[model samples]
Target: MQVPYLLDVLVSVLLLLGLFFLLTGTFGLLRLRDVYARMHATSKSTTFGVAGVVLASLLYLRYLGLSSGLKESLIVLFLFLTAPVGAHMIARAAYRAGVSLWQGGVVDDFKKWLDENR
Candidate 1:
């Protein structure tokens, strides 16, 4: 039996949204001026993009009567848990190494906090 049109449309939308996020992340990685900003773009967008793709796959598997939803959900959970922590560690490393922020960017709150605490 053929799949329903609504399922097809939903899958298409999810895939397209995921692809869009991935592409935007790639663009940001290339075009952004500072290490912190670039790291932010890459981690956040890639996490969302991969989650979307995994969600689409989960939905498709459910429609096909497959039992892989738990796997996909776990993958998304790991991504959500790790991406921000990874980004923060990288940014902190860059900061400790004396990587400067973008010229036009606003206040360096983290740096100020570090100064005040130390």
Candidate 2:
């Protein structure tokens, strides 16, 4: 068994990374020029945040050898799968609602991609 000190440091580092994701998500939501950008920020940040926290919990539980129901595992997997879809839907809805990209947005891959999809 690894020492508690090492586990404590690991948990602390994980928490810091989680906090970084959360703050960046908030900043992106505020500073980004368009809804699509906002969605991209939130999707990427929150998925990682949720994954990190879930992984930490999973590790802690397993380290103690608890008979957990694997709920943490499920959460990590669920977020990983769904976050991108949710972001895509948000971007699509924004596009349909006529939210334009920022000035100098330069490339509209999503626009072209959507055009191709339809």
Candidate 3:
């Protein structure tokens, strides 16, 4: 039926999109000049990437009459909740430990904040 065909198309698109973002995150992790930039890239892109893949899985499972994808939904919820917070903690620790930004970085907002708050 057309419904199944549409679902297939949507799942395929989500998978491809997820894979693209995952690849981009990996590339940024390898190629970026500094930790902060690497974290930013990986956290943002990979979160969305994994979300897309999980959503696709959820849809396919629903199509197959599986149990409503509660596990996949939880995974997405936890990933979104944790990834950015984890990245922030790591970045803050790195900054406190004197990890310098890339030479080409344009902003030092955290540094300014620390200075202002001190």
* Candidate 1 lDDT over residue span 11-108, tens digit each: 88998899899999999999999998899789989998998899899988888988659999999999999998999999989999999999999887
What residue runs in model 3 are displaced by over 4 Å at the alpha carbon?
1-3, 112-118
Q: Considering every candidate listed, which one attains the maximal TM-score?
A: 1
lDDT score, candidate 1, position 46 = 99
Provide the lDDT at 45 for model 3.
Answer: 95
What order do you get sorting by lDDT, best first? Answer: 3, 1, 2
Give one digit per residue, the lDDT tens place, for model 2 in 24-74.
998999998878778878889988876777777776777788848388888
Alpha carbon lDDT of each predicted model: 0.91, 0.80, 0.92
Q: Please state every model's RMSD to the true fold in angstroms.
A: 1.7, 3.4, 2.5
- Per-candidate count of clashing residue pairs (backbone under 3 Å): 0, 0, 0
Which window of ten consecutive residues has the lowest lDDT sum in model 1? 59-68
Return the TM-score for candidate 1, rounded to 2 decimals.
0.89
Could you tell me every candidate's TM-score relative to the true structure?
0.89, 0.81, 0.87
